[model samples]
Structures are given as C-alpha cells and as structure tokens.
Target: MDRLIVMKTFVTVAKSSSFSAAARELAISGSLVSRHVADLERQVGVRLVNRTARSVSLTDAGTRYADFARRILSEIDEEDTALSESRDRPEGTLSVICPKWIGTLDLGDAIAAFVKAHPLITMRFELGGMSDRNYDFLERGYDVAFHTRDLRDSNVLVRRVSELPFVLVAAADYVRRHGAPTTTAELAEHQCILHPNDPVWRLGAGAETSHHKVQHPSVVANSYLVIEKLVEQGAGIALIPRRPAVERLASGDLVEVLPQHQPPARALYAVHGPGGHTPERVRIFLDFMTVWFRSRPAAHAA
Candidate 1:
C-alpha cells in the first residue's frame, strides 16, 4: 500500500477511534481500514492501536505518531491549497527569451505594460542568445520563448499571438530623386540599404515570392531602427516590419517601392513547455501580449 494512503487511513481511524467509523468516513470496507492500520503500524515498526470488544484506543507511541501525522497531513493540505489558489492569482517570476531584433522592436512596450499591470509577476526578459532549437529555452529555465516563424517542434506548445507584416519601403524623396524600382531586378541598379544579418531580401508572397540577394549596398546595419532612420534620410529602399514603418508610411515620409507585390507576413508566436498545465504567469503574459498586439493599429492594418 502507498504510504500516504495508509497514513491517511490511519489518521482517520485515530481521529474517529473506531475502525467502522473510519471505514464509513473513507467509504472503504472495515477490513480494509483494519488492514491499513496494520500496514502502517508494521511500516513504522510499532503498535499504533489497541482494540477491545467494545472500544478502540491508541498506545503512547501511537498518540505521539498520530500527532505528528496529523500535523504533516494538515501542512500538506495547506500547501496544496496555497498552490491551487496561486494558479488563479498568477504570482511568480516569468522568464522569457526572444530574438534581439524582435525584442528591440515594439515587444518591449508590451512587456513594460505587462509588468505594470501585473506587479506580482517578476519579469526576466532576455534579448538574443537564443538557440535554434525551440525547446532549448525550457532547459535553460525559461518559462516562455517568442518566435517570429512557425515552429515544427512537438516538444513545445505554440500560441500564435499576431501576424507581423513587412513592407518594402523607401523615402519619398529618394523615390523622386532616383526613381522607384519597377522590378526586383531593378533593385541592383539602385542603392539598397541592407541589414547584414538578413542579406537576402524577399519580395512578393506564396509561390510568387522572389528572393533577391543584396550583394552591393549603400549602407549596412544590424539594427532595424538604424536602417529605418537611414531609409528616412533617403539613403535607399529597404524592407521593414510594418509596425515600425506604419507611422512613417502614414505621414508620407516613406512610400512603398513595390506596391503590387507583398512580402510574406511572419506570425508572432509565444511558445512554452508542452503540458496541460501552463504556469499562470506564462498564460497571463501571453494573453496580455495577444491583447496588446490586437489593440495596435498596425496589427489591424496587417
């Protein structure tokens, strides 16, 4: 028999002081209750109960053991209740990891909002240093990880928060000065601002999509914010995530180069460990971010 089962049965019997009463309370047979007490006493190597024709009582050792067992069981119940209640309240440290580019973008604002909204949840947001393996973050003690692409790993649970659209944009002045490229091939004739990390520029969508390798560029930078600034200065045409480019596009500082063709949109995903019970902190954070993304004007436009 399981120790806890025998312990619980013995505790019930000790409280009621009758095998039949404990059996009735536990909804088990009287013989099973007697067997449990016998098993528990044998496990402890001591006599825990004395039975007479009319009544039942505990020995001196049984009295002390029962007291300890009662305390142990009570503490366990208290801890269990506290844990169950905590699942609803969502109070704990939530570790999250994501790519540097995505983190550097507008995700930080959502995170800041979440921190302010949920003061009880401590945040450990790490930018960059992510492994290609999706489930690696779980091994590194991360409660959640953000991905901009579809994840094929079966070991993690994936939640699609939003779609991040991309636009091939150029400053209005640059378009006027040099003339906009009508085709992907024409990009080679123009000075194109390129991010060194992702040199291959993608254009169009689905099966119609064309990938252009940017060999010669007027400017190269790791940061998209820097690239955006350079593009605003009429440096060159660059592909930018629509969220950051929305205001500039609206203000007419930037205009689309290839308006007919659309770039493939990347889905923003929040991934956590594969399990039925997701930690409350992770669930709330994901939910807050989903709401935050949906509330954004850029998301609506996307």
Candidate 2:
C-alpha cells in the first residue's frame, strides 16, 4: 500500500518483464508483486503492462514512468547516503557563536587551527551579540555557543570547555600613585573599574575565597577590552580575563594587584541544543576547544 513500495515493485517488474521474477528478486509473493503493479497503474490511471502467453512487456506509459521512477529512486538513495555520512563524518557547515572578547583571542586561535586541520568542515564563527537568555543561540540557528558562565537550562546541553582565569590588574602608574592593596580589606579604599554584570570580585579559592564588591567605580563598561584599556590609562583597577591581557602583562603594561590573593577562575562552557546525538562537526569543534584551553593553563594563572 505504501507508494514507495509499489513504485519499487513496479520498477523491478518493468526491468524483469515478469511478475514471478520481480517477486523472487524482492523476496515477496508473486501475487503481491502483481497487486503492487495493479495499484500503481490504478493510481496513475493507465495500464502499465502487457502480458502474453510466453512473455510480459511494458506499455508506452509504463516505459516513461519506469524511467522517472528509476531516477527518483536513485536520487532518494543518494540523499539517504549523504545524510547518513553527515552523521558520522565532519563535513558540513558548523555555525558557532561566542562572546566578542573570547572569540578574538585564544579561543579564536583554537578555532582557526580546527579549520586548518579539518578542511572538510566549513565553520561560521561569530563574536559578541550573545543573548542573556541561554537557549537563544538554538533559535538563532547556531550549532554551538560559548559561555564564560555556568548555564542550567533544561532546553540546552552544556560541556565544560575549560576554566578561564580572572586577574586583578592595575597600571604601573596607578599602583605607584595609589599604592597596591596588600590585604583584601585594603581593596575597599582603591578605585575600581567594574563591569555592571560582575560587580563583585571573588578572590582566592576554596574556603579562603572572599567576595569584594566594587565600592568606588571610576568607570563602568560592559566590554572587558575597554576596561583593560582604561586600567592601562591609570583610570582604575579592574578584574579581567587573563587571555587577552597576556601580552600586556608580559610587556609590563599591566601589573597584578594583591599577588597573594587571586580571583576565582570561571568555567568556560560550550552550549548547544539538547540532543542525545551531537553532530560530528559540533562534537569535533568542542573537543578541539577543550584541548586548546587545557594546553594553555599557564596563561590562565592569575
């Protein structure tokens, strides 16, 4: 009764020119094969076969229909094979999104390396413009979204990519002018540049951890790069991700404040839609990013 089954039976019968042969080839009963051809003919409103005492042959309409059917079946097979291969092979366009700052630094380098290694995979990497709502990336058609914070969404899936280190930095000029805070309590007296979303800086690790809320913010900006620049200009002390600040720290442009007390590291996460089977492209990319961050743990130290 299924159209594809009937089409297949008719196609086989057309090739063999015998219902018995088609039944034998398809491993069905001869009557079923005859019924399949009859159903197909009735659907098309045309007699598709001519039977003689010794042989069977296709009618004029049957010959044309046979050709179309064969082509359609062939295309269907090709499409099925392609889809199956895509599930196993990493050979498709992978759309990914992340925060603007992370996408521009070490994470960007990892993605670039992945692109070079897997020539079959086409990647679309976007920076910034991430929504506060966690699952928004899935609706926007992104295959993966990177996050610096932990996400607890039932509609989405998450993997721990790496732990990102946060460093409290101030310019050499600022340190000379205000003097560095030797203890956690002294930080209250210093001018701080704060990200509105991250007003409290969690210092230390484990039980020794302490939270310091920004008491006097000289400048408030959402962009970490802008905050880094402001910190370099001696505007105020700020806590920032260490990856982008690596070069500046090495060049002595920025100095760490309260060397004994470092801010707690945050986990970097890769978020995707909830599914038991992750696409090969997205899976491979997530694996690569995890390794990339793991290899650069030194840069993550505050």
Candidate 3:
C-alpha cells in the first residue's frame, strides 16, 4: 500500500468516523478502507479505532496519531501546491497587515514596488493600531502580517527579516529649553513621551548594555505616529525608531539625544499563519517579503 494513500485514508476515516463515509469520500470500497486501516494498525501494533454497530470512535493513541497524521497530510498538500503554483501563473490578491510606523516608512514603498512588478497581483495593506491584535489578521482574511514585537503563539510561523534601530529624540528647541541629560541618571529630569507600558529603554555602549527608566511624559498617546508628531512639535523627548525619524533628524526638526547611548535595535518579523496547510499565494508573499526587507537599508539603518 502506498504510504501517502494510507495516510489519506486514515485521515478521511478519522474525520468522517465511519468506514462507509471514508470510502465514499475517497471513492474506494468500504472493504478496501477497512483493509487499509487494518494494515495501518498492524504496522503501528495498536488498535486505532473502536468500531461497534452503533458508533465508531478513536482510541486514545489513535486520537493523537490522527492529529499528527492530519498535520503531515496537510503539509504534504501545501508542499505539492507550492511546487505546482511556482511553475504556473502567479496571480492572486495578497493581503497584508503591519504596524503603523513601519508601514508608513520604507515598507509601504517596497509593497508598492512589489505591486508594480506583479501587475496581476492585488494587494491590501492594513495599518495596525495599538489595539490591533496580530492573530486577528487571520480572521480578517489577511495573508501575512509584519510585526516588531515578540509573539507568544508557537503555531504561527515567524521569520526575522531585519532589525530596526530606535533612538531617544527631542526637538532642538525642547532640548535647549529643557537642558540635555549628560547621564542616564538625568533622564528622569526631562519631560519624556512614554509609549504607555514600554518604560524600559536599553542604552547600548560598546559591548555593555544599560537600561534606563524613562521619565513618564506629561502626555501619553497610544499611537507612535502621534508620539513622533508631539516630539517633532517640541512637546517632549520620545524614543522612536530611526527610519521614521530620519527626515526630521536631517532637517533639524528633531535631534538625537545621547547618540552614543542609543538603545538596542528591535527586530522586524514577517509572521504568517501555520504552514501546515498554507496557500501557495501566502507562501510566495512571505518569501518575497523576507527577501525584500533583507535587501533594504531603511529596515536596518541606525
């Protein structure tokens, strides 16, 4: 018996819970399905299913094996689909979700270029706010999600594409008026724009790492863009990523404070749904995003 065919038959039986149903679904004889199950049970040396006149249920070990078998079969299907789609025409709508700041910066441009290159592909980019949940993207029908924070779920596939540098910045006027802090100890004296719960700032010095407790700002905003604007308008000093603050720094609208003690970089990751049964379009989009971000300086620059 072919191993793939046996696995498929097992999965079908497990899902339908009846040999007749499995046989009908696979368009094979019920006796053949029963024989396959018997062969699989013999190979494993255990009874997988308990069948009676009234009901058919999986045994404890059978339940676990069924889960694994389902995942294996799904992966095989996904791999086959990916290989087939690679040779065929690539045409599909690619949906993406990303944090607000990064999307506004270089990521937006890269996506635009991707769309231009693949005229047949349609793209939908959703900007995530502070309250947006990453997993909600799956429910909202997004194909991929870009995130900068650590994920808790082990099921999702996460790939670190690049690192983004963050810096403590303030408008020149604000710094001059408030006086620059020469030491981390003096950071508490100034009005800081806090990112709500993110209070610890990692200041880097050569091989050493130093953490500073930033002084809470007089005002707190959930949006990073709002924080950047507040700092740009000389509201207060804010810890912001390098890319979004680049133009302001060059134009002298915002100045990097204590550049030598800049914080450790944050990782930008491309997260996707589980690959066990992922679609070909989603896999292709994820591959493209990884390659696209890796080659861009804006995602890695300090």
Worst 10 residues of 2 by lDDT: 293-302
Ranking by TM-score: 1, 2, 3
Top of the candidates by TM-score: 1
Candidate order, lDDT descending: 1, 2, 3
- Name the weakest run of 10 consecutive residues (lDDT summed) in model 1: 293-302
Model 1 TM-score on a 0 to 1 scale:
0.90
TM-score: the better of candidates 2 and 3: 2
lDDT of 2 by residue, 154-272 (tens): 99999998887889999989998989899888888989999887888888888888889887788899888799889999987899988788888888889999767888777889998
In model 3, the clashing pairs are none
User: Model 2, residue 92: what's the lDDT?
Assistant: 88
True-vs-predicted CA distance for residue 138, candidate 3, Å: 2.8
Clashes per model (N, Cα, C within 3 A): 0, 1, 0
Please estimate how well model 1 matches the true structure, expressed as its whole-model Cα lDDT. 0.89
Residues 111-218 of candidate 1: C-alpha lDDT, one tens digit per residue: 999999999999999999999899999999999999987898899999999877888889999999999999998989999888886689878888778999988988
C-alpha RMSD values across all candidates: 2.3, 3.0, 11.8
Position 26, candidate 2: lDDT: 100
Candidate 3 structure quality by residue, lDDT tens digits, 65-141: 89999999899899989877763545677788887777876778778877887787788888874335657777778
